[model samples]
Target: MSTNFTYFADMSRKGIFSGHIQAMVYDRSKPFNSLPLLPPTGIEEDVDILKKLVSSSRALASVDGKVQRLPNPSMLVNTISLQEAKASSEIENIFTTEDELYKAVSDTIQEGQASPSTKEVLRYRESLWEGYRRIQEKGTIDLDGIVAIFSKIKNTSGGIRPPHSLTVIRRGQSEFRAGEIIYTPPRGPGIVEHLMANLLDYLSDKVDPNTDPLLKMCISHYQFEAIHPFPDGNGRSGRILNLLYLVNKGLLNHPILYLSKYIIVHKDDYYHHLAGVTQAGKWKPWILYILDAVEQTAKLTNQLITNILEQMESTLEHGRETIKWYTKEINELLFSQPYLKPKLVGDRLKIASRTTLNKYFSELQAAGMLAQIKDGREVFYINRDLVKILEG
Candidate 1:
């Protein structure tokens, strides 16, 4: 590593430089073949970094405890994962509204009703759940598993970017320097494979056994983005890997943390810190950024969970008092997802008659516990409070 205070000071003022600069030989236009391997030296020794890690770890543990204590943890997983999917996709410029996404999940939207963006967002959610499942089963994700996740996210059978693929990350189209190259990921005959292998090893603790899991996650994320292993969906795949890594390490029992929300709020800082690591060897800022994301996201998620639990309890109490047919099962079903179709409700509650199910919905709506919304010939009963909480 080299120190160029004058040069980095300018970049730092522009939010591009952080800790220190790497070798000057690094070029943005050419392939980053010299990209360093995992477990960067002295990162674990920084007192400031260690302090952030401790606070982040504590906040993350709090979220894990809150999630486990829920009677229907899968409900939180379902809602939060979809939220992550939407936020992560939005980062890539994929746009979709929360209503459309929830409608798609509720199946109230007919075939071809979901826009391409919404479908893509749903695929992200699917990929996230699948990755979490694979982590639980295998206790670790290998290169093949990584490819599988990317494949599911992209809805293609394609694997890693071959040696010939010319993938270059660039600025957004709306930016002043639109289409300008920001960084060229590693490319060569075996460079990607070798780097990916090292990343997998590091993730499995085979390379950096003493490194903290959270710190290792931040390092692996940068390396994965730098490697740019897949031809597409690398960013989304890397985000999924973040949650899965936390779960695999037992820091989280379920992949429910909405880290993407934090990234969305700090989009500029996120990219700058990533660039900090790639352009310069500034691990401290990137590490601190991710630590802040984890800690803040954990607190936000914890608050979201608290709001949801409170809403559920209040809804249950009100429904019990207002509706004659109201039961705990109905409240649980309604809160399982923000949107619900009549048939889904009937099927879940084992109500065999359409007329009876209709009455239940009507009574619930009349009691102000559910709001009715129409989409074409279909009807959806929405828990508006739940939707508001989720949208937040």
Candidate 2:
């Protein structure tokens, strides 16, 4: 909590906290116009943290830009996207086993045909790719793009929450009596749209030249989450926006450096830092937390990329040494889909028949390069080492 950084509390209601809405009900009118804080001052620690964030951002950008040079970079994109999907969805308590997720990925065109958990994870990946495509096409971010991201995550016709929607942040496993409200976001016929408009400006070149783009991104994330624009999918959407904003600003060439797994591991601090800003005007801690997440997740991702490359090399070597024949194309296919199918493998290697591809899978499995797992009656062969690396 910073005594110097000043923040005004929106004269919002606290009934969401205690679940008592009689005389204690807050009118819920917290105006947030803190977007263009020129200095964003009050925290003496921000200078150092900002420097660190700049360096860390560059370090991440280095590998992200170089990873594209790899032979099969989409492997990282798809694998990282799915890992991020799983972690981000896990934050919402949507759980799926590793086997279930990999098998779901092996399925070609897995939109509606999956268990609820697996389907939801796949939607996150789909929406992320969609968001990436939109940003690439338009070279800008918009509310509709975000709506598209969330709609896929929830698999619905999604958009901003309507003013009449009684969407309050709460946590529980039951009905109205399940849990007390943690926060009540602004409610109005146009509050969400209005806030989002201001957010769009900050994300672009029109505002706050003094604040670094990365700093602006941290502020943007907090603002988006605080706005709670949608009735559902806000968390996943906000996270997707984080990466889009980075790519939009050219901080990352790809979305491989997502912070979901890191945030999931430090979820307590993630929420606490956000709450610290709202409760006591503590901006430095929140800024530092996000910067730290960027730094740490970048390191992990760089290492993951390194491990992936090394494993690819080792797999090639092992195949050539132990088997009578070898093809880098075949191994690339296996890496492309961690859970490999004979049809997918055949398509990649120009083999037409499943009967013939089965021989290849058997050879790979026999050489200790692939492991077979049966989802039901259908068996799926996977690169055991690669899957383990991805599951990390």
Candidate 3:
């Protein structure tokens, strides 16, 4: 294969070295160009619309430092729209429910539960939920809390966090090398200094304290990823930075922006826009994409929350009629923990025997609020209506 090389000044007059890579200066005035930068195609354009809606949905979900409640209706609609696109997409191994994705992201951040394999997804959900809660209470974002999210998503496949090295592979090659480095950044010296300093400046200057915090977050995300300074963890760190930036701007009481869901769904486009900006200095397309994502995500999220409420209300009405004794208790239990085990019901309601808990759950199932997923020793109950509400 043909090789492409870049060289820097030698180590005598003024030079530095770190890692196994070497660098050199290139003519800055030369026209730097890459492959043809094209706008989204027809199918991609359609998907892009959904991506925008989901992005908006996520922004609206922010707690805004405990000053705002749940996202407004527009936000819910966008969230649901994005979810629909995700479910309809032909991508393999994609999560079908908003709950599954949200739970995965939230749990990871809040509990610090590391996935030995992709376990971080569960914690992702937990952490995200708590992030929203924090917004409600504190009315600010939390950077450190957001950064702890990646430990949970099990690195199953598809390179969750690729090392900061130029990747090279022909059409059919399976293996690759890491140390074939090039493209030295404009920093005088030190990697973290160049990236971190700019980030801190943007956070202080460009970010408007009052204008929609989520919008500011999208800007911060673009700036961080463009720098791509870290040798590793840049992707994950950039993402985490989104949540923290929101917190810093006081747009959310909790750092619960559902960005990854949209990004993961539109993974190809996300990369495409980022590359377009770096290669061609094209910012409009990326900015539009980010704005669109925030708008839609927020709308869809709000709708899901509404759907959940409706489902809960319907279940409560049924419980009042059939399961009279523990109707309120069971309803509260479902609201608190949508994923319920028989033992959990028994424990929460103070029921003595497994038999009684089973009876209560059976009553809920009969009333059409809950459904059972059973296979040998593992028996789980889902609020089917609630699931339906969220996906819708």
Candidate 4:
């Protein structure tokens, strides 16, 4: 459906625009003190948004349902959350390899030995889990919860940016207009808080109760990025907030949707749509892009989960048929993560006898279920199939 320019016209009357309504102009170099508030009218009635919303909601619900059926949902949570953390960080140009991430998670290397980028990525995962727990306990998302997320992500005790901080979103060094200001967030005393309070109210349905939760997510995401409350890590924090918002609205049981992968794939379009909202008040393209991200990521995640489950079943069948020491407990432990250490396996399985533990590993390796890797004195088994699915 098509929405007239009334929303922008109303916003202009409210002082959101710096020039005539026809031009819809605003200065990008200055703090955007007049940024419009949340719950833009007419979004719920847009035909294109509603059409995409149906498929997006269905796809998201499918993921939630499949995760609930797993014997150990936390296993999938741990794996998928890390993947999300990695991709989200990469969006900000913080890169880390899968090997480093899995190895750090498995404790095969010392914490201090992990690269700075890997540590930051781990912190992002920690922030995600912490936010999940807080939402579960509080039954609502609040300013304190958001601050906690940003703090954990950057490993700082700092809260929102003070009025003095001059923050501006800029282009990357590789871009043609590198270092040029893209958009400056709303600033000045009480301005950020005012916008954020409206955002929180919108999330709680205090602004508009009729809007669908999925649609609210799309709108709130844009508002959060536009607000840009924090000095750094706003991108990562906003991404985490997307998942938590889904869980808070009951559309997701756990944050296992893998949404960032789609964003990474369409990185340029992602930024363009975000800018469209701020510059020209183009909500349809932005909302449609987010809806498509949810739908595509949910489908990809379902397939990935299916592949992992199938691999687990195949591994169990192979072990039961070929290895004499196979057990359901061992199989589950092996699939808990892509990388497994001998000590970790022995400890979890209560196999105190080194000989017996070694035999189990030897048989699994001999059965082609696991590949042995030796790093100096450290030895670990790699679930090749599971890693491939996750990496894919």
For 24-65, candidate 1 gives per-residue lDDT tens digits of 456788987767766677788899999999999999999999
- Candidate 2 C-alpha error for residue 218, in Å: 0.8
Q: Determine which window of 10 residues in candidate 4 has minimal summed lDDT.
A: 15-24
If the candidates were sorted by their lDDT against the true structure, best first, what order would they fall in? Answer: 4, 1, 2, 3
On the 0 to 100 scale, the lDDT of residue 42 in model 2 is 43
lDDT of 4 by residue, 1-392 (tens): 02324644555587663322122477899887777766676677788889999999999999999999888999878988989999999999999998878877877454467899999999999999999999999999999999999999999999999988999988889999899998999887666877888899999998887789999999899999999999999999999999999999999999888999999999999999988888877888999999999999999999988998888888889889997778888888888888888888888878799998888888888989889887677677898988989987
Clashes of each: 0, 1, 86, 0
RMSD (Cα, Å) for all candidates, in order, is: 6.5, 7.0, 10.2, 5.2
Return model 1's CA RMSD, one decimal.
6.5
TM-score of each: 0.93, 0.86, 0.60, 0.93
* lDDT of residue 218 for candidate 1: 86
Model 1 local distance difference test score: 0.86
Better of 1 and 4 by lDDT: 4
Q: Distance from true position, residue 37, model 1, in Å?
A: 1.2
Clashing residue pairs in candidate 1, if any? none
Q: Which candidate number would show the highest lDDT if scored against the true structure?
A: 4
lDDT of 2 by residue, 1-392 (tens): 23211212231232121211122223323433222222344443457775877777787777676687789777778887888999999888888877788888887654245689888888888998999999999999987898899888888885887878777776566545557666677666555665677678778766555567787778788878878888888889899999988888888878777589989999889888876665555677788888888888888888888888899899899888888768787667778867877877777668898777878788888999989887557778878888888876
For lDDT, candidate 1 versus 2, the one ahead is 1
